[model samples]
Target: MNNKKPALRIGIIGGGISGVALALGLCRHSHLQVQLFESAPAFGEVGAGVSFGPNAVCAIAGLGLGETYLHVADRTPEPWEDVWFEWRRGSDASYLGATITPGVGQSSVHRADFLDALAAQLPEGITQFGKRATQVDQQSDELKVLFDDGTEYPCDLLIGADGIKSALRNHVLEGQGLAPQAPRFSGTCAYRGMVDSLHLREAFRVHGIDEHLVDVPQMYLGLDGHILTFPVRNGRIINVVAFISDRSQPEPTWPADAPWVREVSQREMLDAFAGWGDAARAVLECIPTPTIWALHDLVELPGYVHGRVVLIGDAAHAMLPHQGAGAGQGLEDAYFLARLLGDTRTDAGNLAELLEAYDNLRRPRACRVQRTSLETGELYELRDPIVGANEQLLGEVLATRFDWLWNHDLDADLTEARARLGWEPRSRGALRQG
Candidate 1:
């Protein structure tokens, strides 16, 4: 008689990059049953672009996607320059200062293309479309992911990566005697667009500005806000992200209100930056239609795990995008979780220890990134009185601000964690197919 135990059944909420990556990584075991629920009718993304740093590339590489990811990613224009960032005054385009990233470089890609690449890596029949989870209920032996379709999926573990408006996140918070909370606004709004490279080059030529600005992305700084520009798609396009402290709206944002935060006309954005210099105007003028998003992030959760379920990515710790680490942090989460869950020694009966290990390693690091991202924006907008004191200090501060973030090695971290947690390493070939 066969006396072996059943394989772990893992259910993931959200089919975004993080969720799919986690599922794909875990599926390499072939013993773990991984299913993902995506509320969208099909897998896709609606955003303009994302900035991927070396750490992000390494994290994706851990999933065996480093080369595949490079196909869609463009090496940002910082490799040739000694300094990585050129901070400039938005009024006259006068260079305030610049910061150098000694080793770190970034790759930018369209959000849809990245998402498609991740989805393409996932196998068919694993993701159930239009399945929006309403609530997660944990019983004695199994966890139930209740959906809006009056159906429930039973799983041994749940990973919620459903993003900023996640529905399953409530269960994790509520289990800890905490009231369900939504992401809070940071009194900031962003207008985002992508400008064609040829278009930006012509705009710079017409403005009679140094052509170097297009070669290396520039950050035009001003009072209460900043504009960040970078190249994507092998310098064929420029992604423009503008941040402003918007006080035009009321508190506790309600999306039902017409002309809410998600949508803003190009004229409104132009009006907001009316006094900016030519560079800002040049990029702004190229954006035929601007998409606006009210930046909101989660407060630190008391814990990321509850019983058989856990949270990852934005559902656990969404943050401001000032440092461009929001999605990258999510990727990091998937990397750790996949390795922990896929370990041959890990079994469904001992999932609590696995989850505890995840919380111990991932929570602290992700929260630090969240807080750092917030403070970074403050510096960019000259809100931090100290960083705003002088441009030289600002340049120095920005230069080294992200070194620790980019230099982290997940493999080393995993080794340390195993030692710290008394986990025994197993041979990679030992993973049995269920």
Candidate 2:
């Protein structure tokens, strides 16, 4: 007689960093069947560069992508290896402070390059492109993911990594009798562009600005606006994002039909930062064409798990990029969720308890990061009432604001999750052996 259990059918929606990382992590197990559905024809990341903090680095390593990430990740040069960002006043270029996080300062990568690195490791026949999930239907034994191509995929579980504008989000919320929420416009518009590092350095020299600004990651803070620059492509190019806020309205609002991103003239960008210090202008001058992005974040959902359907990454908690921890949070989600689902004790029979454990452990932390990221953006624009323009106070807060976020221990959470699901404690080495 031959008696063997069937593999768990797991379907992941979306193909960005979070979805791909989760897929790679789950694929390590032999008893789990995983498939990823992406809307685009091929895997790609929109945006210039993304930075990860120490906590994110830990999560990446936990997911077994440490070596892969390090191969493409960029860090601040020596002598400033521990500096996250040198903060300065945008008006006069005076130093305000710096965020010093040791060992993993400003570890960033070109979004597309990092995505490519992760996607390259996915097992063949595991991803289906051009599959955009339009709706999710729950049956007695499985969940059905209906794609825009007039096709449906049935799986034991569904994971929504579909980003801020998630279709599965409504399904999850509606199942729980909660009203579906829309993505909230943060009332901030960011102009993004990339510039050649050498050209920016020469501009600094001609403009008599500090050339070190080009080599190291920097944040120029001002009233109602800020500019951020960091190296990508192994220091050959610099990624720039300049932000402008409109606070006239008491509450955040944006038109539902308006395009989120649009092209704008360089002159418009220059005029936005007019009267700023030479350092800020020099970086902006390098980009002849720039795109303006209407920054939007999801309204916090009441929960991330409902039945066999769950959410991850921006689908659950999309936040502003002020803390540079948004992507890191997604990575953390992938790490925790993958570990739970890949645990030896997890099976189709007890999926509810295991997924609930995941929701209990991850929801609080990701939501907190979401809230802090928005606050950090306000602080960068000098809108924080407590630390407003107080250089000493701002410096003190900047030095340690990220300690709780970056110094988190994901292994401990895994242990707690195991206990929650009545599973025996297993050492990291033994868990990997499974």
Candidate 3:
């Protein structure tokens, strides 16, 4: 009789940032057999620049990717290339108030580079590409996962990090007296792309804006929406994102089979930011072809755990990008959950309780960020129901609203969560956010 125990099997759907992060974290502890599936044929086509606050940078660093992240990230510090965020009255391009901060650790990275960094950290043969998940069902002893290729994987636990339109999300919500929900557009769409810094330099230089200032981040506030621009790829290119609330996506629901990204002409982009400042217009001029992204967010999920399956990242709580913390929140989820699951003492008997603990701790925080992101967008557009065109309060709102999001301490949060579960073992994989 062979009595060797089988390893705990973990099946993760979707290979976006969050899924990849979780796979990397679980791989740190050899007891877990981790497998990640992606719908795409391969990784590294995320199609945009991602900004991570100091808090998220610390999370990435704690995951043992700090040095690699520093190599691939845009860490151009301030005083040389200081970050300046100016809130100008959108109607005429007048400065409201400005906040200056050193760009030391708030790393903005190319999505491909970031994904590549994460994918590289995983052990060989762990991530399987082109596996689109079709169905997930919990059986008496294990969970069964089906793919489009007519293959099935039965595992001890399942995680649906599949992203906004997750098929696994649909599975978890099935038969809960809740009709599966689809993502709804936030009444806004954005034209985003990478613009060569040379084009922006020429545009700003001709306008008498300092050439040095071209590398810094900028925000152009307006009536219906705003323009946010920042440098990425080591200042080789600038990422430009211009958002507008007027663009009517009448069918606000995200189409399942349709591409969320489509090409938009320069004329459409120019017309979208036409009424904004010279700086905003200049940034728009640099984008020859822009990819329009319709922002969609979920209303809310009552919880994040269903049986042994848990939802993370966009699958659980998708939000607006106004805070630039959506990905950060997802990374936080990966790290926090990984710590709980990595504990050797955690067994099948307590797996349900531990997952419920994850839901109890993570859901409120992620959902709060979702609500905060919505409010932040309204404030940026000067259309806040509470502010109501009050420019003075708008400045106040922009100045310190992000302190909580940027300076979060993950180690402390996990400690509190551990106490809530009434189990405190010596720290294994947890690290304080430095």
Candidate 4:
């Protein structure tokens, strides 16, 4: 009689969307035991808005959490109409060419609601909050995680699903005698806020924004800036993001406390849009208060995992939101790595090789989006000929390839991972959802 344990115990750091999504995926494998650690006091995400294209929605659907997402989120099938452009500083608001579509089906949702849906799917007692990881080191045969309270927990593998500002990443990379590179400012900043659709309707003669535009996504281009607006919470709230150029030195990473910053005045915002269209200026006026973000991007790391520790989501790759795949790519990493770790045969020695393969598969796709996102930002912030050229090129070249982005099958990717990495095979008749 062989009486061995059925599941492999794993420790996951970070409890954001990426971490929670990965935990839910691992839970689907009855042979895997997972524990998640979060630094924050509670489970929630920190952004105002998020866009889930077909690719991301498909990933969530595969996790069996799509119904929850649909219940809590505003599900809109239409994408924003072609991005329009006008010179904000000019006397006349001239029409710059518009971009039709980017690729696939897309929808917008409140960031917190999306995170909550992912966290809700986890079984009770699986997540431990208020446990900030202070240090990561190997203790005997297991990976030891030391928290701020002077306590430690040991596990077979430590998954640093922690976000872009990851403490575990610092411990691992710095411990390897490599100084972690800081995120550089991309010469841009963003002012984000949300307003009621009623206020916007009362403010301007909204031409393109109607009932259809509520579900449809829209980006308006200007000289050295662009504004994107979309619906959330069943089209009850409209989320707006204003992007502009910032030539100053890159600021600190987000979620930082800077007490000296003043509120963005209506006057300052109006000055920024001195010559923009009535529509663009009208939307800016409707904003109550805007949170400014000095846009930043990090250089790609050579590897995602070393030893028994692997990186996922923003911890591995952080990109601009121009492509709208920042969260989607992170979700992809979570689903991909969860499947890799579900294999019973995975061990420390071959773990490096497996991680390298994960990087090989993910890096190019991520890097491409990173670069494309930067270019897209540049195109939207243009105030001259670049804006016209970009719009023309986007209509002629870019929007057609969106179908490929929205319709990816993440489950099939997992199936391939099982075969490629020698993971345990499921019985043909027994299919598991999520």
Candidate 5:
């Protein structure tokens, strides 16, 4: 038997889905000792609605959590029906085409349930909650992490799954004489909320909305603003998000809490969306109270990995939610890292090589998605002919763009890496668990 001491001790900062999912990916490996640190009070995730496309579903299913995910969440057959649009010819309205066919199969879920499934798959006694990682120190041999409560831990590798506002990102860049910037407002504020489908239907009935309003996701576009709505939780609830680019003075800042705590009342919503279609008006009216999230995005890092520390998810490349792949890409990062670390040739001397391979495999693809998502955001705000043309092209070209992403198999990469290093495969399925 090829018995060798486990390659390295791994430490993960931040206990979000990315961290926990990475833990599950690394579970079958007895070669590495892993620790996950979180700032939250408990070992779970908190959030509202999110989408999981087939690419994301493939990653999760590969982790052996598909059945568990379905048990705790809704599994809709057709989650994405259309990308609706409204075009105005000098104030005259027209219904632009709704791109019904999508590149990937998708399902919506309450974000909390998705995280719970991943957390359940994690090995026991490995997660440390309420222990906020305030700092990371890169030593000559290992990386040292310091918590807010003055406790310290060390490991051979450090993974910053902390989030967009990652402390490790700053530490690594500053260590290399580069300063990282936090995400800033994108001049758009989103009003997000979820309501029961029955309530939505009743409200629409009294207000005279389109009969097909509840069928699929609907996007109402205007000049510099847009409204998006979709069904979730087995179609039990409808989630709505209204994005507006206001010209007035910027709004006041608020603490990071549920998106609903800072809502501009129903009256305010009506004022903002007064000129929108009646269907959107009814959907907005049905929302109990909408929480507002100021949209923000981060510029791509020049390097995603450095020395013993590497960044993943929002920490490495935070993008706008136009494609709804922020969380999915994070899951991809976790799975990709599992492939790298579990490789037969993954030794201390070649750790840098593994990191480079990971960056090379992911950065270009992710950056393309990031740029396309931004373009989609601009497309969503269209009230012009150009946007209509772009929408048609988007529907036609989406599949081509996502082919490599959706078809990627980390096991293949791991196998390739081992072959490149002249190592024989010990077991076909040893590198991956699910």
Candidate 6:
């Protein structure tokens, strides 16, 4: 007589970093049947370079992707391994301050490369591509995920790891009789491109700018704009994102049907930073082709959980990129959710409560990060009324601004989450410590 408990059918929407990471974490358990549906035909990530602070690094490690991440992630060389970014005035290159984050400073990876590394680790027959989810139908015991192709998938639990424009988010909001919220444009557009590190070094030297800027990450701040550069691909390339903001409007806005990313000419990028200092101009000149990205973030949701459906990553709390914590928060989301769902005590009868515990533990922290990210962008662009470009005050704020975000203890949070679920705390060694 074979009397085994039925496996839980877990469906994950979207195949971005958080989705795949969560899938990987859940797959570690033999009883959880995980299936990942991606809108794209294959696993991929868009964007040039993504940096992770110490907090993100720990989350990545906690998710069992530490080796893969470290394999491709670029870190500052010795003597500057702790420097997050050196801040300078965009007009004159005068040093403002430097943010030193010990152990993991400006660690970054090309988006595509990191995603590829993560995708390689997935178990076979786990992911389906070209499957764009349109809506989710919640039944009494199971949820039906409808795709754009007129097909549907029935699962025990559904998780939305989709990007800013999420279909399952609509289901979650509508389930509670609330209207879905659209992503709000932050009135900031980033001009992004990559430059050859060696060539950029030569350009810096030719323009009589410090070559040291190329060796480590640097942020040049202006009145209404800021330019940041960090090494990627093992320092072979320098990724640059130059941001220009329009703050005239009292409230931020973006056309509903407008595209978020588009290609723009080098001339347009140059004109935006026309009067910047030699170092800033040198970095900009290296990129003959640049693409502009309209930055948008989601307003805080009332909750991330509604019955068996949950939202993670950008679907829950998309934010500005100023603090470089967006992806990290997503990874943290994956870590907590994966740990909670994979707990031995978690089962079909208690899944909803476990999810609530996950939301209770994660929602507040992620929303705080989201809010702080916007404020950080304002601080970066010198829009803060109090700081107002005061170099001394800016320096002091920069030194400790990321302390809370970076110094977070994920294990403790996991313990608290277990407590919320009325489960006894497990030792750190007993759980997968990444």
* Per-candidate clashes, comma-separated: 0, 0, 0, 11, 3, 0
Better of 2 and 5 by lDDT: 2
Q: Per-residue error at 271 for model 1, in Å?
A: 1.6
Reference-based lDDT, residue 144, model 3: 82
User: For residues 272-333, could you state the per-residue lDDT of candidate 1 as single tens digits?
Assistant: 89999998888889988888877889888778988988999999999999888989999999
Backbone clashes (count) for model 2? 0
Candidate 5 vs 6: which has more lDDT: 6
- Residue pairs with colliding backbones in model 6 are none
Measured on C-alpha atoms, candidate 2 has an lDDT of: 0.90
Minimal lDDT window, size 10, model 6: 425-434
Q: State the displacement of the C-alpha of residue 426, model 2, in Å, after optimal TM-score superposition.
A: 11
Q: Model 5: runs farther than 4 Å from truth?
A: 1-3, 44-46, 73-95, 100-104, 247-261, 383-434
Model 4 TM-score (2 dp): 0.83
lDDT of 3 by residue, 90-176 (tens): 655566766544454336889888888888878888988889988887877768899999888888899999888888777677735
Give per-residue CA lDDT, model 5, range 1-434, as digits (tens): 97776657888988888888888777577767888888888766545877765677766766656676667554334444323222221122234444332543445677787787768777788888888888787767767989999999888888999887788888767765787767655567788888788988887788666545675665666667777777777778877887887545454343356342365677887677777766777778887677777777777667787788888988887887877778888888887787667655567777777776666667766777677666767666762345453556534443354455455565665554555445655455543221
**C-alpha lDDT values of all predictions:** 0.81, 0.90, 0.79, 0.68, 0.69, 0.89
Would you give me the overall lDDT of model 4?
Answer: 0.68
Model 5 scores what on Cα lDDT? 0.69
Error of 5 at 171 (Å): 1.7
lDDT string for model 2 (1-434, tens) is 76677889999999999999999999989889999999999999999899999989999999999999999999999999999999998987888889998988889999999999999999899999999988888977668999989999989999999999887988889889999978899999999999999999899999988788988899999999999999998899999999999999978788877899999999999999999999999899999999999999987678998899999999999999999988999999999988888887788888999888788788888888889889998889989989997878987899899999998888888887787677866455432100
Candidate 4 residue lDDT tens string, 50-151: 887667776776666777777876644533333321122222234333334344334567889888777877899999999998888874566888999888
Off by over 4 Å in 6: 1-3, 425-434
